[model samples]
Target: MKISVFAITATTIVAVFAVSGSSPSAFAQVANRPVLVVSSGVADISTLDPDRATNVGDVGVVSEIFNGLARFAPGSADPKEIQPDLAEKWQTSADKKTWIFYLRKGVQFHGGYGEMKAADVVYSMRRAADPKRSSFAADFAMIDKVEALDDYTVRFTLKYPDSTFLGLVSNYHGGSIVSGAAAEKLGNKFGQSPIGTGPFVFSQLVTQQYLTLVANDTYFRGAPKLASITYRMILSDSARELAVSTGEIDLIGGKREQRWVKRAEGRGMNVDIFNPAEFRTLFLNRNIKPLDNLKVRQAIATVINVDEIVRYAGKDVAEKGCSVVPNGYLGGNCGSGGYTYDVARAKKLLADAGFPSGITLRSVVSNASAQQPIMQIIQAQLAQAGIKLDMEVVDHATYQAKSRRDQSALVFYGAARFPNADNWLREFYDSAASIGAPGAMSNFAHCSVADSDIRAARVEPDPLRQLMLWKQAQQKIHDDVCAVPLFGLKQVWAHGDRVRFGYELKGALNLQPPITELTTVTRSAP
Candidate 1:
């Protein structure tokens, strides 16, 4: 099991086989070349196919190699304004049920694959929607059909008016376009090794150690500045810090350790801090006892001091979170402010709900160092309320599997992207979102009331009316204690001074990195 890190960096570089020699001279010789070394904090690159990937770490890599029809510009805190990637421009019908897109010309897939066409976009959408593929298609479930009107023009028909349709299309995995022919030829292996029309091309996979990519001169947007990028898998956070400090690697991904963050800044290493519009929270399975009772759930939520946790996590590392809907989400009503840290109130609620002394609650947490503190703090707080929490920590893979099965009374996890309140409400409260389902994504709470309110918000298309509906949904979910919201994570990364890139403090880490905006900086003769 590797500790996965999520962030976006861009470049163009050629692939070169490293000579098998363990010496500083070998590394220093290559240091002059434009390269970024990342600790593959996570295991197996898994599927390079964005549509199939659920982990944020995987998406970070996928975003580099693939070009979506539309992309969230780097530094876009809001989802309403999306910049072009593959598509030059797009328009929506006045009724908001139809969409038309114009594809960029002269864009070719890596490896001289072929020219990108409108048919490819249509095929990709169909593939994403196919039941056999089983990607995160529910977000696009409202799309009734997709058709190529011309060589560069494509149209999308929706089942109903959806204001969030464009935002959904810009989703990390939702918007990745795969070649129709490649999908058929490679079958399942298509995910392991994907071909895209982006700035980088897949070169070689060296098992668990690392993956190598070369620059695509034929990239539609423009030629990438770097010649190559080597992603090294560094599982241990300490090892990653050491690698970055010692110059063994050029960059470190995801949130860095507090010690490393300070060290990197002190050393003049570029430290990018990004605040994603998402939060980590404790999800309560309503089917379970104690948590099933609204008062007990609310009491538990009120007892935790989020500000204290944020302070402990480190300054500029995290901010206080109020609700499932992130602060800037469209049509979102942020949940009530500040957790009321009242042990007396918690005790009374637990006792009133017949969950008094000797009541043991099970909490399933992911085996990550970052999450450990949160669990420990909650356990102590719950104990004071007369609730004994049995902490069960599992590896990431097992944690992800069990979470979907709803096997725990409580689960602590984070949503990678929460661009809109719909994502928040839909996953936690829709009937189809329940753990036991043909389309279950992450509704581990098994919250039926939340599901109803979320459904109502989804169907309401009027902007102001939709906001009202979403607010009601959030309030209802909060009032019912569907889940206890934690704090929003502030992403931190460490990189060597040689590399240059921009970081978006909101949305996904990459959006539009410096690679797309600047020329590659070549090493000057020292």
Candidate 2:
């Protein structure tokens, strides 16, 4: 397969919004306001509480209102730099078990809440570790306890050494620290009215309609340049594009198709695309026979045409993936032995596995419109290798539960983790962590071949050494043909002339349009 690299240089070329949807004079009327109108397709942003933020929409809202101890820089090309936020500095013991953090003084939470301190950090983190309070409780399992050493000092004792511990508690949505006083005062209502030490503070949430946030004037990072930001829920694809094209909204979460990219660019709008991409991996259940047969598995892997999948599934918005842990990031890419698209080899392997007559493989997938197309593409590709994919379409939740329960012979799962590869390799391939094993997040394939390497990688303190262990695990997965790696989801977003990203394009955690404090708006972009 030929590798393609595409990059667009950002220039201030501007155009007028001419698409027929909203009023033509809209831009002029809204030119003076320092409000950014973002069109997000997510319709279920019911909470602002970071711990309970299950969807990317809620996570995006939470990101604006909260700060983790450390965070990814605003316009960083890579997610590697661990910059301090609420925590001024942090250090770990030589054993790499105990972590101490010194908090920044005078950082205030929204709504005139008292100054943030070590106690607030401890309270927030402890609450996030509780299973009932956080959907990502498993992420915090490494923590034995969190203690406030003093008013500005906090300590965390870990059950074992974990190199990705900082990222898990620093950049992930679950890492957002809320004001303990605010949570107690507001109780369950805290999710709607969140208070944090971020650049922007929550102003109001209009349910499924939109959310509003105003600049935190006393923000430690300095007041956000944009006076306010308004996130609008525009679920319809046509409507969303029209809004951006007609200048009704400043920006919209773009569709993944290359054709959509072309349309947005043709209109002279700015299209922003970046990585570490979300991986769309094809997992074949080893617990099921035939698939349990190495030849059959290898045959399916050979026939898995990722290029065709990328063509059909938005080539511009995806990269041909090589590992279960996406192609790029701190994790090393050791995919020299990865499967390439070869139908002849697949046919031979299928015949050797006693599937010359063509075998039917049962599968289950989410019936969501975005997901169904990719599943159909997989079904079509498998047919080329004398394998009939009899996929049963179900709702999103059912698909996840059934896949985890080991009910499917084939599962095409698209996902992104917190820019780390260690936890990803463990939760997906380690026997003790996968679904069939006890307390599994998602081991859909029920794999254990890389269990030892994955375990070793997790506890390795040195970043390079830990990455070496992770590559070993990744290689094991590649050699076993444990799963077919598809393309990573290419994220694309388009904005009108009225707005330009305040900072350079950078990586984000699957939030379609990550509008950070650095995202800037012009008095008029054109």
Candidate 3:
């Protein structure tokens, strides 16, 4: 699936597009132009509605226009640092299953709906938990009830005490608060156009062109420094690199290839790279033939040259993934000591599985420029082990849709999950998250290799013990051969010197450039 949150595409880049809010006089055309122009490598945004967005690209925009009860520390990339947003402060009962939130007063919704109140917060959160209304409902399903106690206070009663609950409802994009009045007034069309109490207000979405937003002067935090922000979709990697190099765009998401990394540095641009990043893992359908056989799965794992694959995958941009949870992840980095690259071992396993001569299997992958090369490496690696992976390259979005239906024997998926370890483990290995299950958004592989460990980890009150449980769950996944934890991808975002992030770039929760109220764009020194 095209999750540039787990995304990478190859296409030609073009000039940035600018739209003036008002028709300018012939002499004033340049004067009314936007102060800042940015480029995003997304092919397109799914929806502006936070509840409907499944990909990071859409969530990026949603985050800009909404607030949650809490948020990742603004101006900081550390996912562990959480601070209040809509909720000025909150407290949990002694049991830790009940939460009381005191929202900030004087927050106003865009389009002047009125002051944001506890009723709006209650309505917004309940809508997100409603399975029929949100694909993200499963993330918040633990909440048994939500109550608005007053105009500025809300309460949540949970089924259990989950340490990740605050993170689940706030740091995750699904927790974004939308105006209840606006949502009802607009209905399904709200996704096309949305209203929120964020630093920016949605102005326009020109298909395949750009999504433009104007600053919210009355923002509770403060007015954004940039007068307007334009998200230009750049499909071509080479073009995107060139745009940043030539200063045609203030910022661009750089390609994962190390060569691109070096080239950008050569041009004197600043590139930010961080770890505990996306996981580019291969999921083998256990319900499918050959793959379902334990020996066959083992053989496939033994033959995969993960090191060589990373060699081709930009060693500096990525490294060997240790587990289902990437290194330094929330629960704690742990791996299921995978089989080494040994062709003989692979052959022996294949023979033991009764396929002495070898077996041929078909797999599907996205034909995106960056992905094809990696798949080709896997194809070649498998052939050496006498297993032929007949590769079918499909459009990225189609691959995501088809994979969820169990359409392929093998699937290559990538994602930058919420920082919590349980979020990743459960979505990939929980039966409840299996494809076609109610409220399923991920879990394309349809395998539940470690359901119990993950469940145990979710309820573990002790932080250290909880992390240990999460690690055990990842080990279970690796041992079961449900998927091969390929490598942890290091994300790169390059920008010209003129744009200031206003903070250190660590790791992002949603894998997008961490731009927020405190972010600023300063003119480069003359």
Q: Best candidate per lDDT, number? A: 3
Better of 1 and 3 by TM-score: 3
- Give the poorly placed runs of model 2, Cα more than 4 Å off: 1-33, 92-98, 111-113, 159-161, 184-193, 203-207, 287-293, 312-316, 344-356, 366-370, 391-408, 436-438, 461-468, 510-513, 518-526
lDDT of each structure? 0.68, 0.74, 0.76
Candidate 1 local lDDT, 233-315, one digit each (tens) = 66687777767766667677644346657766886667777656246778888888867778878778867777667676666
Can you rank all candidates by lDDT, best first? 3, 2, 1
Per-residue CA lDDT of model 2 for 1-526, tens digit only, reads 6531111001100011233131222122322336777866766476788887765567767878889998876645254676888899999999889999999999987766779998899889988878677767777888999999899999999988876677866746588888899898988888877878887766656666776666665778775666667788767878878777776678777777788788889987788776656678888898888788989999898887777878876766888776778776567575545687788898999888888887898998877545778888878888987889888998666776688788899888877776668767766777866665545666778888888888777767777888788888888888788888887886667888777566666766636555665666665453
For residue 415, model 1's alpha carbon misses the true position, in angstroms, by: 1.6
lDDT of 1 at 111: 45
Error of 3 at 355 (Å): 2.2
For model 3, how does the per-residue alpha-carbon lDDT over 414-513 read when each residue is reduced to its tens digit?
A: 7776767878887777878877787576666666778888888787778888878887777777787888888877777888887877677776666667
Candidate 1 worst ten-residue window by lDDT: 20-29
Candidate 1 positional error at 24, Å: 29
RMSD of 2: 8.6
For each candidate, C-alpha RMSD in Å?
5.5, 8.6, 5.9
Candidate 1 overall lDDT versus native: 0.68
Give candidate 3's TM-score.
0.89
Better of 1 and 2 by lDDT: 2
Backbone clash total, candidate 3:
5
